[model samples]
Target: MSAPSHTTSYYAASANDKNLRPALQGQVEADICVIGAGYTGLSTALHLAESGFKVVVLEATRIGFGASGRNGGQIVHSYSRDIDFIEKHYGDKAGAEMGKMAFEGGKIIRRFVDQYNIQCDLKDGGIFAACNGKQMRELESKKALWETHGHNNLELLSDTDIQKYVGTTRYKGALLDKSGGHFHPLNLVLGEAAALESLGGVIYEDSPVTRVEEGAKAKVHTENGSVSANFVVVAGNAYLGGLIPKLQAKTMPCGTQVITTEPLSEAQQKALLPNGQCVEDCNYLLDYFRLSGDGRLIYGGGVTYGAREPDKIESLIVPKMLKTFPELKGVKIDYAWTGNFLLTLMRLPQFGRVSNNIYYAQGYSGHGVTCSHLAGKVLSDAIQGQAERYDVFAGLPQYPFPGGRTFRIPYTAMGAWYYTLRDKLGI
Candidate 1:
């Protein structure tokens, strides 16, 4: 089947400014060559350019054409996996270090927004809503964990308090993190792309890296051109194919779908979410939604491992929205689409060197909105010979799917079905 088109998301339709960059041509040489033009690749290019390194970035399509452009745009400061999972797998100290590293993702994103004056309609509040007693207990435990870590500004809310912000009683309780927020993810990436250009960095769109030859210097090949550089960074999340075989074994592509409703009037918007905070339910198969700056309801959920398209994505997600806000039964959905995300077995970001000079990062689960920015900075730092922060993530353990490349899709689908069943049973 042909790949799904970029979603007619509120972000894509209402982007503040859109520019089409030219594709690659002829041979080129740079100090560093980065693949993928999403958040991770653009962020790395911008930082490296600022640090006085000659940089070139190659993208398979336009910038933000992948999940970076199509996501629900929630810029939360945590990973999709829980903190307890980290503590249990690693030691307490290692868990804390990972927690701190993940938390810093939010800081880096906010700082970039402020420093660059990117107008992405950023909002500064978010809630993790609980649909059942078990989920509420989990939220409370997470609240306590944050407090124990001296991270203030995290408030525990009863169902009543949650109703004030979310305008729904479907949830039993919530954990409100003031630092967690949402923004226009596409705008964030485009602004970073512009910043990189301003610093003399080169970017070539529609130039998919077909092959990577590893050695003291790496050679990346495209149809019309090639880039030979001292260092090569692979930042393509799910769209990257066969560029690096070993890295592909360590990750599986998972599909996620999203839909957006037409703009509601001011009063209708107020009735939907009075506080304008992004909200998501607590379930293994989660539902996340938030109002766009233009008053559209941007709701995203549903994960599938198969490449086959869903018969109806908007229909699948609209009922989930109605379950949260029954008042909007007649609301019109303007757009719906799906994107792929790279998921690792451990559900952590995977970072490692393919060879001496070829570094790669992927498998951010569903948290790439902010984590990609953090990954870019760390990867850039590693290319510059400072590997402390990069090592923190690279040192983490990763396991390839049991069946390797050929069976990854089937195994991931089976695992997803099990999780979906557990979610349905409220386990």
Candidate 2:
């Protein structure tokens, strides 16, 4: 089969820098070898390199070429999974710890952007809007749970307050998080990658890991070359493919489609999002949107569990955008694209070792932007012989998709249909 093509999104056209790093050739050795130059791998490489470890990152494509670069750029404060779900499955102590991790994950992202002087258009306002009373109640419950853990940055907003911020009457209420915001996701990833290189880390783009030999020392194979390292970290997430058979079975691919409109007038931009806040409605399959630095409306929200791209992604997403802001009736969509992300059955990130020297992290379940950053830090710590944080995620049980590889597409489609129905029925 041929390799998958990159998404044709506005991000690609307006990328911060377009320098392509050469792929791996011949052979090399390092203290740590990371696969996938997306957020997880790049962050792991960056942190490990800063710690004085010789690190090399292998990317199937260029850095941020996957969901890391193409996502809606919302810096949400929690995982895609519900906190109640975590509490019910794991005990209170474990649940609370996971909650803390989710909360701290957002902080970790902001801290890195600040410390590294990353110019990713960082902002600090986000809202989880409620479209109905039920969602409002859910948001309130979430607020209480967060408050229980001393997370006071969350503010519950009424319909009136919500309107003031979002300039839309469709939402009944909202949960505003002052600590959460949005940014240029691709820029952030690239900045981190550059930072990693500055710390003497090596990065090889277009170097897909074809196989892994796990033991005390692991060897990661590419098409033309390989890296033999003391520790190997698999941060490929959705793009991992068959590198590790077990890891692939635990998560299925889901495609997310997005589009950006031609730059709106300054006045028009403000009228849509008054405070320049990033907003998403409270729903299982959610719509997330934010105004770009130059005023284009970057809107995203549809999910396809299948690996193939939808024949008409723009038509599928544009109507949804119009539903929210009918004011942009005649606006032209400048770009449309889709990216595949991994959705694990448990909704929690999957982290564990194929062997003592081979560690892997994936299944952020759409929370990869921030969680991957945290995953990188945690994975780096584990590589350095500290396993407390790593163990927390690795302890989470992961069930393989029931239908195996052949039936994964159909199974995911059926499951997505159920959620789509719920979202439509407002259940």
Candidate 3:
């Protein structure tokens, strides 16, 4: 029952659910077929199942095998682009609806945990650390924007105040989202998978969908079998390879690295991140860290815009970790891993339908954990004849990277470098 296909992450090592499900062999039928087992697929299928619909999920490898299992684990709110982008580019009405859903994703996660009694070691508190005055000012504006949407569970911490939440003096200040938190991401997905099963939902591992034949009843084909269903949900995110040519062209997959250190003693934990909340610094390419349930410091940062895995993950991450926690110089790193996430030029999630019956949601950038859950609910609402919220997302314009496949990486990396420099010069 071991998940051999899953990445050798700290989460996989400490996974509570190792239940191996059978792969698709023969043709199966369902009300809806979800083509990924990550958060988006699980959330959509689970929501549909709860509404008394027959749901079947086909995972290419294993549950939480993608970014769903291996992320910063911070329950951050809002999209990567934030609400201002929506209001300016789209309109105020779209902005209002998008704003309402901004904080609901985290709430949905908590609701699933309490309603299903899923044991994922959920924790409280998350901080947006600012390394400079300009970043601190940006945090102030971000706080105001969230407040305008009626989300008020936030506190602005001065440099002195942040030192209590984080042991390091790297931050000039921070914005604390009391509703934002962290958890065992893999366990959360596994628990939700169990919750989906409780509603008679079915999931198949090692079931890479080859092609989805579009129709009133789309046929989701895998290597060995197929699923003919009333509707198809394409929720594979970055790992979804050439299945849909149109989708592959609109999004680019990018890699992010994460590492975990040997468990720290109680005193060690107290000295670093005394409040035990997840912390992500304010930078274009950011560094995020938090204390794991067993006291290990799970630190993650850096991005490979081209989706290529770094040759040495520890080399890219260790020095950064030490920069944040110099006291932990020479600390033993127990795990280092890299995973891919989908990104868009606009930095907003791409939600739409293919041929009217096949629905899809992807391109979460780095905010997949929270946004994917909201996507699931919105996608379900659309399928169940409630398309208002879904249209709010689908109506947004989607643009392909300007450089095409040949130079998109360099182009995106160049833009990121420009922003990173802005962060450095405090401009």
Off by over 4 Å in 1: 1-5, 306-311
Better TM-score candidate (1, 3): 3
After superposing candidate 3, which stretches have Cα over 4 Å from the reference?
A: 1-4, 305-311
User: Model 1: which ten-residue window has the lowest total lDDT?
Assistant: 1-10
Model 3 agreement with the true structure over 242-349: per-residue lDDT tens digits: 889889888888888999999999999999988889999989899999999999999998888533343488888989999989999988988888899998999999
lDDT of each: 0.84, 0.86, 0.92
- What is the Å distance of residue 190 in model 1 from its true position? 0.9
The sequence of per-residue lDDT tens digits that candidate 1 reaches over residues 1-427 is 4433345667878887676778889999999999998988888888799899999999888788888888888867667676677889877876787777767777777887898888888999889998888888998898887766656689989989888898887988999999888988888888888878888998898788888888788899999999999999999988887777778888988888888888999998898889999988888778999998888889988887644343478667888999988988988888887888889998988888888998888989988887888888999899999998888888889898897888888887888789888767778
TM-score to native of every candidate shown: 0.95, 0.96, 0.98
Pairs of colliding residues, candidate 3: none
Estimate, for each residue in 134-159, the C-alpha lDDT of model 2 and write its tens digit: 89999999999878776788889999
Displacement of residue 108 (Cα, Å) in model 1 is: 1.3
| Candidate number of the best lDDT | 3
Ranking by TM-score: 3, 2, 1
